[model samples]
Target: MTAPARYPVTVQFGEVNGEPATWAIETLPEALAAVPLGDHGVFIVGAVDPDAFDESDVSVLELLAANAVAAMDAADRRRRLRTYEDALKNVDDMVCVLDGDGAVTYATGPFVSWIGADDLGDVAGRPLDALVDEADAPRVADAVAALTDAATEAGGAPEPTRTVDLTADRDSDRRSRHGELRLSRLSDHGAGVVGSLSDTTDLRRTRTELSAERDRFRRLFDRIPDPVIEVVLEPEETVIDGANPAFEAQFGVDETTLRGRTIDALDIHDDRLGDP
Candidate 1:
């Protein structure tokens, strides 16, 4: 931001040259006329006689340079924004940007697809709650608000919210899709919050089904008429982890006493362990 000696620079941010102020003036023998645009080029106006142009002309050059610098900076910002938009379009997971009030300012393709919007226009300006069900909407809004508030704190750094499950708005069939949401405060969001969402409905359903299968197996194990127990075979000993109802009843030992205990530590008579 500092100006050059005598010449007064309006804007230049590439790199600082160690060249002295007298360097430019020394290039031209006649009137005060020598300007270095950048490392590659120099503008030297040497008049046949002295006093060809006044100090006013130099001020005009400074103004021109400043304007060019401003224009370059604006163009750079536009280019970066285009690149970001392109990236968001190709992403499968959703990215949401909320304003300070927890309203959607920007949304990625995934979010747009979920809301059945043809484009961002239909999705933008909506509250974060619009994507999630009523019960989950409040939790999402509160997390975003908390991060936005934390970012404004005097000297504290805002932390991302823990990944939580969110149920999407019910579809025509009244079926809900689940997603894992993580909220954060990014510099790009300014005073707002950024939310990342990954669809986990299929994974969640698989886990639930697996849990049900385990429960059915447990019930079958308990109904076995013979004394049955499940044990972990360790290097040193077999450890009892589970015992069926018949085993627990015949052994006259509670499930808690049998669990986590090695067979040698149980002190059961040898006749009782005949089948084992």
Candidate 2:
């Protein structure tokens, strides 16, 4: 049987004919078509005979090549995915990805551990806000909605940082956790949000304690009989930064009047004046 024109050789893929051909071979159109009429019909042009080639032998070779290509493609895809997964896992912040409907698509390792989940499988594809307490679920939804809208409006620049307060079931009790959430728009037009969730229970408690302490200090300072003065020591600048109510009453002074006034001009017991 006549053969087609001698095809080129590929380093990884052997030549189409016994004789050497061009270094480059087109895969899609040029390589596949070899005909005397330049049509789909088979024509004899090559120095070698393809008839001597066994059907099974050629089949096996093609199959192996196809399988190799498929495997390589799959490996490349997996590697890319793994690279992203590793990046997400290494991040200290809780990173979560969600679909347009607020369903969880991918969640990082931190979130799984933070929520005490063995893996993301349980949460994957689930409505993320469902995990939140009913009282807070609506808020989570709202934040997600706002983030989505903002991203759409910004042409996917990235949603601005927002603080979301949500309740999670931790140790069998509803615990409030504050998260700084940032949303990103996915190529598929879905949205993904990633940020850190810090257990702010301690921070809130500390703030409350500090507030109480401040109130206590204010009460003590206000009740003291002697006029306790707080001066801006540096620059020798003294505008009453703070004045106790007692200090005001004793001097027949209003606290507002005491503020922003030079100490030298103020009337005080002359005995207290000293060389500065």
State TM-scores per candidate. 0.63, 0.56
Across residues 54-171, which tens digit of lDDT does each residue of candidate 2 receive? 5575565556655655565555544554555677766766777765567776777777666557788988887767865677677677666656544567565445445666545565
The positional error of residue 195 in candidate 1, measured at the CA in angstroms, is 1.9
Off by over 4 Å in 2: 1-83, 116-118, 149-159, 169-179, 182-190, 231-236, 260-265, 269-276
lDDT of 1 at 5: 54
Clashes (backbone N, CA, C under 3 Å), per candidate, total: 0, 3
- Per-candidate Cα lDDT values, in order, are 0.69, 0.59
What lDDT tens digits, residue by residue, belong to model 1 across residues 1-276?
Answer: 333455422333344476433333323235656555433255555553577777887777666655655565455545554555567677777887666567777788777776556777886788777656778877776677667654456356555564557876666886678888887765443355667888888999999999999999899999989888889999989999988999888877888888999877776787766565
lDDT of 2 at 175: 58
Task: Compute the lDDT of residue 95 as modeled in candidate 1.
Answer: 84
RMSD of 2: 12.1
Top of the candidates by TM-score: 1
Error of 1 at 29 (Å): 31
